[model samples]
Target chain A: LGPVMIVDTPGMDDEGELGLLRIEKCKEVMAKVDIAILVVDGTLGMSDGDRMLKKMFEERNLPYITVYNKLDLVQQRIGKGRTREVPQDSIWVSASDKINITDLKDMVAHLVVDPSNGRKIIADLISEGDIVVLVTPIDEAAPKGRLILPQQQTLRDILDTGAIGVVTQVPQIPEVLASLAKTPALVVTDSQAFKEVNELVPEDILLTSFSMLFARYKGDLGEAILSANYLDKLEDGAKILISEGCTHHRQCNDIGTVKLPKMIEKTTGKNFHFEWSSGDSFPDDLSTFDLVVHCGGCMLNPREMMHRIRICQNAGVPITNYGVIMAKMQGILPRVSAPLLGKK
Target chain B: LGPVMIVDTPGMDDEGELGLLRIEKCKEVMAKVDIAILVVDGTLGMSDGDRMLKKMFEERNLPYITVYNKLDLVQQRIGKGRTREVPQDSIWVSASDKINITDLKDMVAHLVVDPSNGRKIIADLISEGDIVVLVTPIDEAAPKGRLILPQQQTLRDILDTGAIGVVTQVPQIPEVLASLAKTPALVVTDSQAFKEVNELVPEDILLTSFSMLFARYKGDLGEAILSANYLDKLEDGAKILISEGCTHHRQCNDIGTVKLPKMIEKTTGKNFHFEWSSGDSFPDDLSTFDLVVHCGGCMLNPREMMHRIRICQNAGVPITNYGVIMAKMQGILPRVSAPLLGKK
Candidate 1:
């Protein structure tokens, strides 16, 4: 299966207190998994437990595959004649003998629709042989050896599209552009150095940040832009929730905790009560907060990022990401977002 | 912290049988963690339990940082005069007040040496503007929308080195070569299509598979090559262990369980007793097995892959990977391995 997680749960048919707890756990797991594998005993045929599980799956609109195990015993007892009564989509397998296991796997794999259906991080923005310069500052917070995941992925996407990628630090951007045979098609920089890079790169060249590119690629760009602009309307005592997708240690210059908060307060010139959240636990109730400023969400899938946006939409709260907010604060939101918004 | 895993252990001073089990569990966790943080109550100072934990860490050559928390309480009691006795590396902090937390994080990050250390997947092999044709066969096992990780990573590496990457399917290899302005520096393909690719690609062009490139990048290529040769020497009933780095469901045409086993039996004309292992569990005692065939280990880090190789070396059992073995059985081992062996 492609990017599928198969969780094995306890049998639904059980009695007593412990059994009920196990059943509750199974139901909880059912909400997380995309599909279900209902294993039945071929010798005994369909039971009430199987019927109940099937009904639950149907009610939830969860696609599933029914598998009748112990095919060896079934063959030994009924000589393959009774198997005709089994459902059309059901597969008969012997766990020990490895019979029809491949068929069962194929069924599971077929159920998965491609999630990354022709989505590109930046490849779609440029053509083959087009020069795309990336400005990455080697700051104290930068990883020791290689570039960060967003930069690496952007470079890879550009390469996949047959576009030329030129990487340089903030200081070398002017020289890199001067030395190029022709003016580069686009320039991308780290969000933290966006102000300096915006000043360095010429007005003719389209420019954006890694975070901005990912915001458009992974989530709703139009909504994020609207939320970024909403920063100006916040009062002095507004409640802001700062969220990150991954839970790494707080670095000395952590963007979510330190830089972004300082910048937001400075831009609005207002004191705001800030709350921090990281990792998988996003608060379901967003109504308590006046605004939610989230990370670029490189670690999260598009579905999750969209879900967070939808949650904010449902709660009537403004939600923006780190890159979009930084661009907004730097007074170049339109210039930085123009390339991604199809205004270039 | 750079790639650090911090585990909060239960206090070691608990009483009775449950306390002893908790202490044992802490010891087990200590073995897995790279460094330890011994948090001590600032008021109570060092206790016997703390000393015992320190001794255990020292015995295991595990580096540790001792933090005396509740700086406010310590200041109230001693007014910072008694802090001279604390180690130079240790810091006083108040978790609630968020004091000196950044210094503590900086200390942990300093402890980690850069792991990558300028390692390149294929960048070192090619120069700027060097054309590299990649032969990718779109098959049933291929992911729906995007290329697999290895291919994506290799293409990124080539781009990072300023090389031009031309991607084509197996049938288009000839046409891609014909249309190229110059002969490509290297031609890489999926290992499953090696036989056809070998015939289609010119002898002068450096050729290899994604799996073969990863074998060298992540593990010792010489060891893998030797182990692959040992496959021919196996007796009919020799015990062989087939291992995969990831534990995904077996696809109908899975390379590990289906293709490799079939090829191995056909080439060697032997019916060996095969055992399968996947994910993190590697058998400690490999002396019983005559040979171990492993996957390319793209899912695992370089350290873990090398550790597995060392385990095989210690047990005096030959170990090889899927790509190397497949090359050997196809009688193109020398041709494929040469590209990565520095012979080209």
Candidate 2:
């Protein structure tokens, strides 16, 4: 049994058309996606990308729901005489406020999935008491007092599965596994730390990242993570483009710049030339690059992200995002994502 | 001899692909533009659009100076860990910050028209005795106790012209002209008040709006205003999309909503299905409509706006923005846009 999730991406900003890439990646996975969650800013209402993604889902017949995020910013808009809007097939929920999260999950209960894809909804994925270990790093970008939205959502999803969830960091994972009498059913680590977790964990232990699950849930796991294979084919000094969605609190030691480059160098053991572009500086032509590594794109629209992926494909460049690449590099490419990407 | 001016546009969230559009449009008017005033937001560093515009200027071999606007917002960004960024060929001045207006004009003293266009720099176009009447409508959208940025810029442009700027409302323009001994050289009305002002101005006077000047400044004046000719040919029930560039100060009885619609209806004198979309909502298929009425698109990148225009062109739908449409409707299209758009 496994869990299904969705990732709503932001606009083309935060990396020139990075959202477009994610949208293309999402479409690749949409065929098997169990639940499509569209996240939008309540203050801005539905953006061009939001409406475009919804149209994409309608065309694809994806079972999707919408979450109006950032309701805390509502008072300001309301003070200005603007009303909060929930467009069709959507519910308002502030990711920070944790409002209506229960309703959100409950709606997922009646949600339909692609029968051929055999995506086991969380209800069918796990029985009570299955062990789920969340491996997250306490990095500078990690908020001071609390975990970020995606981490919190994953923990909640794990709890909803009735799975016994244990949270640990990459360094603590080997010790945590030593003490566990039974191997955990699943280990979801921060994508940034997935490589090390994979090295220490046994081959049988389930390993994945929130992003990997997101890729599978959104129906892009294979096409997205497969870009990691590009590492082998890349020419020496080849240009690589990496992009992320959010700009706020973008740390100086960003994974897009520091860790991912190190990982690629370690995985291929080659000093591959890299060009790091973030927030909305996505280059127009992706053809020049050997491969493109992208972030989760939580803040971007799914359509724009997909458009970017299609651009890479059209340009004949291999493209993958953080989590999918992490899962592949971490060596749990299958068991971690098989439940969702696998054919029935 | 009126004050002829050029305007630099702002980027639409995604809609203002004006940078790319202008590049293509510039190909037609590269030799025609009298001055190129490159614009950059004072708060948001040199954006991709800005870079693209700069590249276009370089490629076209156009003489351009930069205008860094929104100085008031610059300080706000400083506190938010953001600092002022100035690209070359640009001067940093807050259009909002008083007393720097003269400095902007002084910088413009260096403008050199592309020799091919044969258009003279605006500063040389003005005569000492010409009375330049500016029709400024203080609408709800107008900031409290202050004129809009465009108005303020126009006033400065008038002073630089050495033409006496006779400021008045549309209703008072006739009286002001009568009071003056000589026929005014030009009458620049707010695009929203073009119809009323058009009738009051004599044939010898130049008539235009800021939007018209912007169209010329962006090097697409003729093409944009030409789209308005198709208004009469539009099907009765044919869809018409009206889109604005940004989401700023949507005043009650906004010009986009109230005046543009009323004026268009009065000019066409026929009912047509109308759909109003603002901000970055323009989809790729503008061909579904008989005509697309767009705003000045000051807030969008030229590439994005051109994308819409190209879409409509490909779809066989005529597209015109606010000022262009207004001029055409008044039957004084060429005259209103003439000084800047050329003696059409």
How do the residues B7-104 of candidate 1 rate in per-residue lDDT, one tens digit apiece?
A: 79998887799889988888756644556889988888888888899999899777788888888777777775344367886778889777789988
> What is the TM-score, restricted to chain A, for candidate 2?
0.59
Residue A230's lDDT in candidate 1: 94
The DockQ figures for the candidates are: 0.08, 0.01
Cα lDDT of model 2 by residue, A254-311, tens digit = 7788878888789877787888766555666877788888787664445446656777
Model 2 residue B124 distance off true place after TM-score fit, in angstroms: 77
Q: What is the lDDT of residue A184 in candidate 1?
A: 71
Specify the highest-DockQ model's number: 1
CA displacement after TM-score superposition, residue A189 of candidate 2 (Å): 1.5
Quote the lDDT for B166 in model 2: 46
**Cα-based RMSD of the predictions, in order?**
9.4, 27.3
Worst 10 residues of 1 chain A by lDDT: A138-147
- Among residues 3 or more apart in sequence or in different chains, the pairs in candidate 1 whose N, CA or C atoms overlap within 3 Å are none
